[model samples]
Target: MGVCFSTIKVSGSNSNNNVNHNRKEATKQQTKTTKATAPTRKKQEVVDHQQNNKNVNNEEEKKLKVKEKQGSKAIPCGKRTDFGYDKDFGMRYTIGKLLGHGQFGYTYVATDKANGDRVAVKRIEKNKMILPIAVEDVKREVKILRELTGHENVVQFYNALEDDSYVYIVMELCEGGELLDRILSKKDSRYTEKDAAVVVRQMLKVAAQCHLHGLVHRDMKPENFLFKSTKEDTPLKATDFGLSDFIKPGRKFQDIVGSAYYVAPEVLKRKSGPESDVWSIGVITYILLCGRRPFWDKTEDGIFKEVLKNKPDFRRKPWPTISTSARDFVNKLLVKDPRARLTAAQALSHPWVREGGSASEIPIDISVLSNMRQFVKYSRLKQFALRALASTINEEELADLKDQFDAIDVDKNGAISLEEMRQVVFSLSNL
Candidate 1:
C-alpha cells in the first residue's frame, strides 16, 4: 500500500523570509504584552489566551501520564476484560528481535521452548482494538488461518495466545522476504514471461483455493506474499488476511477495502466478491511482466480512476516484445466486466499460464465443451429463425442486422470465423 512520491523543494529565500516574519510577529506580540495597560481589552484577551494554553498543557501532561500507566499495565481500555484463551505464552516461547510492525501490532521472531523451533509471533496491542469489530477481525483472522492450515501456499498457523494486554498469534516464519522485495531486486524490475508465469501460477492457485473455501482476500498484493526461503525455487506463501472475509455465495462486500493500485472496478463501485481477488491477481501479473503498474498516478484517487476508466497499455516497449499469448492472458484477466473476466481456476488453465507457460494445448474441461456445443446448437436454431424473419422484412430492417454482424467480424473479412464465434461463446458461457 506504500506509494513513492517525488520530493518538493522550497526556495531558500521564501523559507527564510517566512521564518523572519514569524520571529518579528512573535517579538511584536511580546512587546505589546509587556506594554499593555492594566484592565485593558487586549491585556484581558492575552491573559485568557495564556490561561487556555496552561490548561491545554496540563491536559496533555495528564494524557501522557495515563498513557505511561497503560503501558505499564500492558492493557488497553476495553469493555471486554477477558479473552477465553490460554495465557501460557511466556512459558512456551522465548520472544526475540522485532521482525516488523503495523498499525495494530508488531511481529517478532520467537523460539519454542519445547522443540527450539523458530516461529513468527504477531503481538497485537489490545489498546488498538478499541472497536468491537476490531476484536472480531483478529478472531476471524485466526479462524481463517486455522482453517487454511496445511495448504502449501498458505502460511502455517501454530497457535493463538492472549496475555493481559495483547493477543499473540504464532505462525510459520518466512525468511525469504516479500514478493515485492524480490521483484524490486530483479535486474530490470521485471520477470521474463516464463518466470512471471511461474509466480503468477502460484498466486492463481492461492486465489483459487481461497475462492473454493468461500473466502475473499480483500487485499491481494505482492506485499502479502512471502517466499519460504532464499532459494531460487522457494515456495511462495500468502500472508496477512486482515482485510479478508468469508463471503457467502452470490453476496457482495460493500466496504471499500484493499490497496488502491490493485483494487477492482466493482470494488470502487461498492460491490465486490471473489472476482475482486482475481482482478488483484491480474494487477500483480501485469506488474510482474511489465515492471510498472498497469494503472498508476501520484495519488490513490487518481489510481482508482485509472483502474476504473483506462485499459492497460500493451503497445509500450516491453509489452510490444512480449508474446501474443501473454498479452491475451492479461487482457482476459483485466476485463472490466467481472463476469467476462477469467476466474482463478480458468486463469490457471489459460495456455500462457498453465504448467508455467509450457502448456501447448488448451485443456477444455468436458463440461465446458459440452456447454459450448449446446450453445452452438442454440445459436444455429436462432439463426434459422432470424433468417426466416429477414426474408419477410425490407432492406431497412436488414441494415440493422448487417451492422451487428460487422461488429462481430473483427477481421473485416465479410464473414465470421470460429475464432470470432469462440469469443462470443466465451463471454456467454461466463454469464
Candidate 2:
C-alpha cells in the first residue's frame, strides 16, 4: 500500500494531509441464508445443473474451472519450468512499461503477444533477499492473497508463478488512479457522504468476504484501495494483499504487520486476527470522510506508537460537522480488543454503510459468492463428499459442526441451528 502518496494535486478531490475527526466523532452506522449462496444472493436462486450445458465445454464452465498455476495437469509442480511458467502455457508476452513499485513488489504493464492482450503483472521479491526480518512480512502477504477468494471487494489473482528471480502474480489491470494521489493533490476534496458510505461499504463488503475465508487483510487504507472513477468499465479491484494472513480456527497471528497510519492496536503486540483488519477499516473510514489519515506524524516509530496509544480528539477534526452513525461505526472497529470488534459482515449492516447502498454497495452489483473459481476450488469433489456425508448424519453427525463452534452449549441447550451457521458463514465470507 502506498501511504506516501504523490501531492501533484487533482480536480474534484478530498482535502488535507490528515483527518481531524476523533473516534468519538464517529457515532453510528450500524448476513446469510440457507443453501449455498451465490456471492450476490439478494434472494433465492438454484443452480440448475441439468438445465444448463453441464456436458459440453462452455465458456462459463471454462471460467468456473479454476486453472491454478500449480494445479494444471500439464503444469504440475515437477513439470513446471524453473520460473514455474508452464511450458504448455509458455511466456508468450513481452514485458511492457514498469507501472510502479510498492513496498515489496513492482507492477508492470505487459503485452501478451499470443492474444494481443494487455495485462498487469506483479513481481514479488523473496523477503530473505533483503533481510531476515522481511521474511515474515513476505509470507504474511503471499499467504493471505493465495488463501482468499470469492469477494468482489478484494483484489483478484489470475495466476501465481514461482521463478528463480521472483514470484509473479498476474491480475486485472486497474487504470482509474490511486486514491492517495487524489487525496494529496486536492485542497478542498470532500468526498460526499454518499460516496464515502459506498466506498466504505464496498470495502467492508470485501473485508467481510475475507473474514469468511479465514484470512485477515491486516492492511486496510485508501492507499491499499484502488479507485477508477475515470473509466466506465470496472470501478477497481482492491490491490495489495501482501500484508494478509489466514488465521486458523481458534487461532490468531502474532506478527505486527501493516502500515502505521492504519495499524490496529492488537497488531502492535504482534497478536491479532479479523479484528486487526477491522481496525484498518476504521482508519480508512476516517480518511474517506475527513480526507486525511486519522493519525499523522513525521516519525514511523511515533506513528506506530500513536496507533497503539492515543485516540483522535473529535474537537480537533477540521470538518464543521459529521454524522452520528459514521462516528458510531468507527468506534466499533477501533475497539482495542479483537473479540470486541464488529465482524466485517456486521459492519456492512451498519447504517453508515447502508445509507448510500445504491451508489456504493450495489453500484457494480458484484457478488463474489458466485465466483466460478470459488465453486471450482472450494466446492470441489471433496466438499461435495463432505456435504454428502453430512446429509447421512444420525445424531452423531451434528457433533462435528457443533464442535467447530464451541459457542453452542455442550448439551445443545442453545438452539443454534444451521440457519445461524449459514449466517456466520456469510458474515465471515470475506476471510
Top candidate (TM-score): 1
Q: Give one digit per residue, the lDDT tens place, for model 2 in 131-179.
A: 3334445545555666654456556566666555466677666666665
Q: After superposition, how far is residue 284 of candidate 2 from its true place, in Å?
A: 1.2
RMSD of each: 26.4, 37.4
Segments in model 1 whose C-alpha atoms lie over 4 Å from true places: 1-81, 184-191, 356-431
What value does the lDDT take at residue 23 in candidate 2?
A: 18
Q: Candidates' TM-scores?
A: 0.65, 0.57
TM-score of 1: 0.65
